[model samples]
Target: MVRRLSIWAVGLVIAACAQAPAVPPQASAQETPIAEYGFGVLADLAGTRWRGEPGEADKEHGQPADYSEWDWDLGGSVLVNRHVLEDGSYGGVTYVQLSRKPGVLDYVYITSANFRTSGTMTLNADGSWTAEEDVKGLPHILKVRSTGRRHADGTMSGVSEFLGDDGEWTPGHSFTYSQTTAPLPDLVPSGSPPE
Candidate 1:
């Protein structure tokens, strides 16, 4: 009888150890979706003035120049606060911001043009996000459709495209915003945020 009781006790211990712990249903209910984050860069193509190639400058002097034929490159990332939306979706707006510093080429010349921007991100239930910003009297908008998953270490990667008013498509600008926990320092002044 003593041996039988000992075996029963061991079996009970094993069974208890094998059973999964009870996870509260509400815990899952309150869980937020995986968040996303990233950075971006933008070039003011409209402000670009193309002085023809070095030798061609002399050939095209004093002529009505064409500023419309210039190249601009814009890129950036977003740091999403929450990965999912409130409606059981995969994303939502959290406490995160997008920032940009001017490129080397943008600063070399003494042009009155300034390169700066600031904006917020909103993740949609359908795995999409919209980034909106107003900078230097121009409005910038980006719409992203997530095409990837969040990793175990809390990182997500996805592609995004830029949209413009007047229903026209801008060329040569695309981005991939990644989510990270790394802290970013404030580059702007005390009362204002950097663009």
Candidate 2:
């Protein structure tokens, strides 16, 4: 029975691998030209949250935890910047800052983390764009990909992925945002201003 089960598992794994997406060929390093663009940052203030199975082995062994009851109140902002390449494709870096609000959960306190993600953003003539980022960190790495339409009002809507620590890339999160009309404040210089 055990031998049969192992065969079944192996068959399932092969079937799943056949369903993965094919990677596109990269542009030649020497042929690709680098282009850059400056973009203003915007915040999506509707409030974000994340919930998942607890990491504790004891908790999982004792009883099944209700994941629906576990969640954290968090907020995040995305700084979008883009550059065009000689291959006619575009790429850019998006700096994302995420913070969890205090006293939002009963059992856990979420700490603040920032991710500086750099990826390729391809703009299609059809008013649609796709952005992909490969994020590397200690213990694990993630590949996040997003596809959205650029509205006439300068807003964007799309779905995202939160590839987990196992190195397997999969679609996991979704989000939407509109451009803000308020003017952004100027940045302070490194040196202190004259008092």
Candidate 3:
């Protein structure tokens, strides 16, 4: 009687297995469609505040050193970047998301300077990202482009240029950022620069 019960249980298990649907091997988390499309390319930047001293051009332009922090929002569907000068003189917040086009990202930057930019960022084969933006509310510039690269030593650097009246690209912002724990200046809300 025990052998018959064991056979019955085995038959039930076989029936259940035969009825189960076949599922192909699933991709790993990193190989998911969103990740493969480069949605999380900047994920490593989250979780740390970075500091960068003002470049010579920044000093010439009266800009101060800055701190930047990045984080994932909306369950990792968006990347948010916040930056503030060490002196509390300037700051900006940026929101980035995967563009409709694969391997590209769309971003909007709102500055404390009463200007904002809409841009697209793309990753280069060399592990760098380039951003091209159209400026608004700032009469002196029309468009801007920048490239940022992360170094093996965990430092980040970027070079930017602005479109000039001559249709030429002139030097713009530059910075080399490293992880920081120092206090950062306050960033007044976007569209509401301090008096």
Rank list by TM-score: 3, 2, 1
Q: Give all candidates' CA lDDT scores.
A: 0.22, 0.27, 0.57
Who is ahead in TM-score, 1 or 2? Answer: 2
CA lDDT for candidate 3: 0.57
The TM-score obtained by model 1 is 0.24
- Please identify model 3 stretches exceeding 4 Å from their true place: 1-35, 188-195
Q: What C-alpha RMSD separates each model from the true structure? A: 25.9, 19.7, 20.5
| Alpha carbon lDDT at 130, candidate 1 | 34
Please, what are the lDDT tens digits per residue for candidate 2 over residues 1-195?
Answer: 110111111111111111112222364323321211211111221222111121143233331111111111232223222211112111122232322321110011111122233444433323344455555431244555555543454333444444557866654333233323222222222221111
Model 1 lDDT vs. the true structure?
0.22
lDDT (tens digit, per residue) of candidate 1 on 1-195:
110111111111111112122334444412421132222111122122111111132123321111111122232221222111111211112222332321101111111122232343332223333344323322442221112222334322222233445454333112112222233221222222111
lDDT of 3 by residue, 26-106 (tens): 743233222336554466666667777656766675656667777789898887777776666566778878787755777
The better-scoring model by lDDT among 1 and 3 is: 3
**In model 3, where is the ten-residue run with the lowest total lDDT?**
1-10
Alpha-carbon shift of residue 103 in model 1 (angstroms): 32
Which portions of model 2 miss their true places by more than 4 Å? Answer: 1-114, 152-155, 182-195
Candidate 1 regions exceeding 4 Å error are 1-113, 126-128, 137-155, 163-167, 171-195
